[model samples]
Target: MKKIMFNDKFSLTQAVLEGRKTMTRRIVTYPLKFRGVNVAGYFVCKRPSGEVTEICMYDEDERMIDGGQILPKYKVGEVVAIAQSYKDLGYDPDSLDRDPKDLGIRGFMKHSAGWNNKMFVSAAACKKHIRITGVKCERLQDISEAECLKEGIEEHLKGIQYGFPSNIGYIGQYPFSNPREAFSALIDKVSGKGMFASNPYVFVYEFKLID
Candidate 1:
């Protein structure tokens, strides 16, 4: 039972539930000191925890250079739960029904803002879950057009979908100019302020919601 956080106000979480999102990319916690795929077609690094990380490394040339294998956090076929707010999961212990006099500091703490924070949610208590179907390593900027759609950003050039967020960003006019442009804005926000510019190697996870 592992937990995954999509706490960006549940927009990403909602994408999972709606089947609009099926893929996610994460930055490798460990640094990949090498560039270009090894002669075997990949390269390896290790996390502080000693877990191996194999990344699909390279710039423009796909010429083989180095490679190794290890799934650091999640592996194929592993089912993980979405970390959600306690209130959304209906696990509020206080439930605001206790007598005000009986409720002390500890009781009030249960009702604190942290209760609704995704980091504190447990996998066992989650109602939504997703199973990892695939995993791979690639440059964050190498994401494909189809991959962008899988990440839950819709295209407005064809026309906006009903009940979806307006496709508005500094990248383009009325929806992104293209999938990669939209995805650039998305990864930057999700990973960091300049993630797209950094173009770091990342682990891509393809999953399906099982809730």
Candidate 2:
């Protein structure tokens, strides 16, 4: 199994905790690129001679890739540990910083206090585990409003026009009426400018929590 870190700033960790998020989109860095569009369960590639096709998200032999290293996509049934902040056995949040003696001090023992810090928790400390149920490749802009909701788009609140409601109990994630527009804004916020406009290819995974 492998792990992916999620920050609490955007309420993604909260969304997962609330059981509102079951799907996620990951950007492809393009080092390991594949040609063609995914149709049904196969990737159809057009060549000069003819067309080449293969089952999407899998090698020719259908064996799954181990999730230890960066890869093109996660396979179905592969367990993914969601890295989050919380107290658990077999790990010490106080050891995250330079001083081990700073146990009772604020911002030292609490992983929740240091939101921007990089944290490596034991697999036992991860409160969430997901099993990939489906995977597909497509342009980022291809996400629909329905899909956005699956990405954990929450309801609206005052002041904020759109977006996933803030952690303090705000309304939504963006300032848009619909989920698709809200999702566009979300991508902009998380990925920065030129990202949504670039419309880069992305790997979208559908998953369900197993723990």
Candidate 3:
């Protein structure tokens, strides 16, 4: 098992570039556990432009959570199966097609046994956050807080979630083993584009179980 770290200095841009040139996807694992389960997932990088590319599924060593699954590794420039196209399913003809950044509200950081300080966005959040930053009450309707959190995690695993820009630096830190443990800390929303600093410029810290 490998531990992935997420911090202000983490170089996602470089990871994307390398993944694109090598045609290989990078798997980042964290040490945080969700609902008593160890969380694990990976993201696929698209070649050339190196935009997030695609998200695979969130899986655990024991079993699949939230309908998670294992994704086969693929090379860059190749079509990565990060997620299914809602448009392909033909949901609402009038509604605009859904993109990876239009999935949900709220952004989150992902940590697991393999990863120590890595941040992740939910698939739904990644889809929505990419379209627009901040929260949208309308899109958040009919969803429970737990569900919202899931969206952030799913998106993060997919790599669509944005992190701190190169100019920013770490502001805060915390520690936890599960979502419940970090709930209070995570509830405090950071006011920034990435996971480094909040709008007020407060520092947040969190630590989770790795073993």
Candidate 4:
């Protein structure tokens, strides 16, 4: 699979409208803190052909509320039409109509409707140091949203080294302002360091949220 790279100058909304599927390259350009609030960031998606699209909260909402700004190097309108073509073909993630939470914190919910799981570690440790801190596979067939959270918390407590047992005692028990913040904090804790380290990539796993 091709890796996604960030294009500081692109407009995610225009790319989606042009019909280009967003690539999977994601980054955090700023010092983002998961304060259990509704925070957002930009991500870069790499097309199969190696072209990069910088998709962000702007693509889904048409505005940036988190003090983020578009990169000045790339032209926002240059790839609008090409991106629109991708959208016309139904390749956009935003068009799926599911709540962002339903997509899972790291887009892992798409693989298993019953349970979602992910692990994060240094890229160098991907094979050896990578750890699966959370798992939600206890009851795949009839899981409630509350139960899913409980399983995640249990897994975190079992595998993670810090923060999990101290801050979050049980799944779905934290008073996060939003799911994103809670998920972000979990990623940080599991990674055993800050989230934007040059050599680390947090593995994200997610399961379908039962209605």
Candidate 5:
């Protein structure tokens, strides 16, 4: 099992808290080439149709290294903790301030707040948990509308079904007309300019809230 952190601004942690988000994607940072190889000693595997895909790597004994897994950081049925402050954890909903001395918190203060304060909550103090259901890799631009919806992009937009009686829906942040576009905007905002358009390799995690 592993613990994953989320920033407060993107509302991803919020979406998980609300049980609206069931999936997320993270860019692969390390190059895949290996010795005498291209990126990080990894062999590139592709489907017969020319579509790039992941491979199941094994040694001479037929035993797999990394157990033939990449990204997602967690395996199926493994529990993960969310790194956000929550009211359910005895923190005041209005203030939600954390004390830096709590032994459970292991975060180092980077640029977020006071130099001695914890930048994020500890895994033990996290009020939400999730279980990984599946994992995959894909090009950033290939995400479909359904997949974007699965990322909970719609949760950030206002709509009639969301209890806004006015018929007017808000699409303020990214101002995109669809979930896929909104998702693209979100990736750009978080990663950097032109990131989504660059079509980097990304790890997609399918999960369900367990806490």
Candidate 6:
């Protein structure tokens, strides 16, 4: 089994637990003098041997950049644990049948009193697990309109969108205008500042909660 973590600030972990978020993306950069593409292009590229394939990145100016191997941490169909903070675990030390044991907190001491970071949470303690259903490579900005929603971009909708009764056209009011822009802001927070502007290559993983 593998482990995947999300930011608590954005309530992403909560979203996954509620079955709202089904996909995630992680950036991959070419070390030293390597960089990359836009409008979320997808191309089927084959190497000279016709055995290897890769997605080429393009800059804003439309110049092609060769992105080195885009490797993913988890594979399709693999079961992965969704990490959670110890405080979020709902652990009741007083109610447990057994005595207190190491919960895998990094600086945890018997007398210490603080919540454990999600990264330190052990596999056995993970209450939520997801199974990878799909994986693909794409540039950060290449995300589709639908993909943005899958990334768990929060949307607050006002009723009566475009004077129509349908719920599909409601405008989002979650600080940002719509899903893609909101997702751009989110990736930067998750990855780092300027990551969205750089439009780096990324591995997108689609998954579903199993527990």
Best by lDDT: 1
Alpha carbon deviation, residue 68, candidate 1 (Å): 7.8
> Residue 53 of model 1: what lDDT?
41
Residue 91: error of model 1 in Å? 3.3
- Name the better of 3 and 4 by TM-score: 4
How well does each candidate superpose onto the true structure, as a TM-score?
0.68, 0.62, 0.16, 0.19, 0.64, 0.68
**What range of 10 consecutive residues in model 4 has the weakest lDDT sum?**
122-131
lDDT of each: 0.66, 0.58, 0.26, 0.28, 0.61, 0.65
Model 6 scores a TM of 0.68
Residue lDDT tens for model 5, 1-211: 3467654577777778788778888876653443444432443332222222354444444544444444445566678887654433445433424445444333532322322222345566566789888776777887888888777676343455546554433241454556777787888887888999999777778889987
Model 5 Cα shift for residue 74 (angstroms): 1.6
* Tens-digit lDDT track of model 2 for 149-198: 88887655543332334422222354555677677777777777668788
Q: Give the root-mean-square deviation of each candidate in angstroms.
A: 8.6, 9.8, 20.1, 20.5, 7.7, 7.2
In candidate 3, what are the lDDT values of residues 69-182, reduced to their tens digit? 222222222322222223322334344332333333222211111112112222331121111112111111233434323322111221222243333221112333333323
Ranking by lDDT: 1, 6, 5, 2, 4, 3
Q: How do the residues 1-211 of candidate 1 rate in per-residue lDDT, one tens digit apiece?
A: 8989873642788788889889998877532344542232343433332333454333235533334333547888899998776666665566654323232334543664435565655576678999998877777888988898898777563333433345432222135656788788777777778999998778888999988
Q: Which portions of model 3 show Cα errors greater than 4 Å?
A: 1-129, 132-145, 151-173, 189-211
Q: State the lDDT of candidate 6 residue by residue for 123-160, as single tens digits.
A: 66667899999877767899998888887865555424
Q: Is candidate 3 or candidate 6 better by lDDT?
A: 6
Model 4: how far residue 197 lies from native, Å: 8.5
- Screening candidate 6 with a backbone cut-off below 3 angstroms (N, C-alpha, C), the clashing residue pairs are 37-58, 40-142
What is the alpha-carbon lDDT of model 1 when measured against the actual structure?
Answer: 0.66
Can you tell me which runs of candidate 1 are displaced by over 4 Å? 31-70, 92-114, 157-174
| lDDT of model 6 at position 16 | 91
Worst 10 residues of 3 by lDDT: 128-137
Better of 1 and 2 by lDDT: 1
